[model samples]
Target: MPTLILIAGPNGAGKTTFASEILTTDLKGVRFINADEIARGLSPFDPASVAFKAGRILLRETAELIEAGTSFALESTISGRGHASTLRKAKAAGYRIVIHFLWLSSPQESIARVRSRVKKGGHFVPSEDIRRRYPRLLHNLVHHYLPLADLWFFWDAQGSPPVGLANSMTHAISDVDRFIHDR
Candidate 1:
């Protein structure tokens, strides 16, 4: 059995940081896939072309890995229909799916974080862009994507996970362990 964890959020919501922590700590030996990494060579200021290519590559590689029974975690903004479709495909492929959504306390917080990241010479998505898109992202997660998750958790970037999510994650990890052992 294989598992696919999809971490979704707006820019600067700390999705990558949380995904990396899970990969290094609880989910050692699992593959980590991120479209941002694939598109690293391109300027984030011009996102469309780079994101298109990265999405294509990520889908192809994810399909192959799922077919080969590899457990993986995928981190992405996941704000569009393309990403939603990819998650559907992963579910159809029989991989256990876990979804995590991360957000900041306010759009101001997200804007500040994006600016800080850009100042640090990291990949840049304009603070204005992040601000403009944050509400839509949050809306989509709450209204559409949240229902699709087998096990889901939401986190606040300024603080900790929403209450009981830590416990849910513990249970999900136990389930993942059982899935691996049963296979």
Candidate 2:
């Protein structure tokens, strides 16, 4: 059985940075999938026009890869309605799911990060849109996505991982390994 690790959070919560660190330093040999990478090169970088399409493709590819027994790490904001269905498909495909939510210090911090990213010529989402969406993203994470995980952890991007999440990357990989062998 393969595993699907979701590293999710609001914009600029360091989802991409953290996922890259995990893949490069902590969890070697795990393939990485990110919808933002798929959405790259779209003219004008309008997430509203391209995000859902990329997300659908991401989930489809994820299910296919999991069914073929490929373990992978995925990064996304995952605030859309399709998130639950995507996770369900992965679960039904026999993938153990591990979700990590990266919480920022505050909405202001989140907005600041988004502004910085836009200034740096990264994918551009308006700061006001990110501001408006932050709370809802938190709502989805807490009420919808968190409960679906076989193992979950939350990290404050401004600081270290929370108490129960100490050494989280190693623990997450170990938990996935345990699940795969136990089945």
Candidate 3:
């Protein structure tokens, strides 16, 4: 069976870079998907938006890709109560594989890193309004529920990327290889 790996972390957790590294370094020929990318094209949902309709579409498409026996990685943020269905669908997908959840532990450090990345012209949340709203957002995501990841990769951009994430990615790739060979 092909593997389905979910790479999750807070904002600015280096999840995108980590996913890139995993695809190139460890799991070659695997398809990688990011939820943020999908969400970007989508119309913004209102607080009372009854349209879970698009969500089902997204989940079904993702499931079909997984069922096609293609190795894939999904990167997304699991913000509070809103993302429960998305998580449930991915969890229900028929892929017995490890979930390498790259959890960046420090919100303050992550915020700084995000600001720096935005300044450097990297893809990041817009700094204009986000900078003002970050405190509440961080408090909710970091202090509230749904912040935990299955496998933790504590990334601090203050220093060089840790070898630990590389090792973890290697282990995940090994697991995928085992799944392929076991068949």
Candidate 4:
């Protein structure tokens, strides 16, 4: 079965890094997509700004990839009602999607990491900006209207996902495959 894995969290939660690790370490025959990359390269925006158009394109591309028989692993900071709508569309399209809500217990380490990345001219937005936007972002993540995922995994400040998280994630995808194949 074609599967959609959404890695989501706040600005500095290592979602992108974890997504890369999943693509490189956890599975074979997986295609990786990063929203920030698509946002920066494919969208119409000033070099310094993120484009909403690109964000929408990212979701569209994800669904299209899932429909095309490729497993998609998406890394995004998708905390909003709009994000739920987008993921729901994927579900409505007959795709099996797993949402991994990567999280840090506190933003302290996360904010520091974001600051360091920005000082190094990283793709992530600045830490100060993240700090200012965090309350709203947290609200969006916790309360936004989206379907709960078939499975969820949490990451810590040390960026350590549970030891069995990868195995469980793969199992979920495999279960979806068995279902599709049996049909």
Question: How does each model score on TM-score?
Answer: 0.78, 0.78, 0.57, 0.70
Candidate 4 weakest lDDT stretch, 10 residues: 174-183
Which candidate do you rate higher for lDDT, 1 or 2? Answer: 2
Candidate 2: tens digits of C-alpha lDDT, residues 1-183 = 678888987888888878878889888989988888877735355655787787777878877786787889888776664666777778888778888778765568778887887799876667777777776776676667766778788666764432233234445444433432343
- Residue pairs of candidate 4 with colliding backbone atoms: none
lDDT comparing candidate 4 with the true structure: 0.61
Candidates arranged by lDDT, highest first: 2, 1, 4, 3
Q: Which candidate should be chosen as best, given lDDT against the real structure?
A: 2
lDDT of 4 by residue, 28-109 (tens): 5677777577766864355346666667677788667756757677766664566566556666666667766565544566
- State which candidate, 2 or 3, has the greater TM-score: 2
Candidate 2 Cα errors over 4 Å, as ranges? 41-49, 159-183
Candidate 1 to truth, TM = 0.78
Q: Mind sharing the TM-score for model 4? A: 0.70
lDDT of 4 at 65: 76
Candidate 1, residue 160: how far the Cα is off, in Å = 7.3
lDDT tens digits, residue span 71-151, model 1 = 888887655656666667777888777888775656677777778887987667766777677767766665566556677
Model 2: pairs clashing at backbone N, Cα or C within 3 Å? none
In model 3, where is the ten-residue run with the lowest total lDDT?
Answer: 145-154
lDDT by residue for model 3 over 63-181, one digit each (tens)?
A: 67755756677765544434334334444664434444344444565667788776886556544434444444434333331222233332333354633432233344344224323
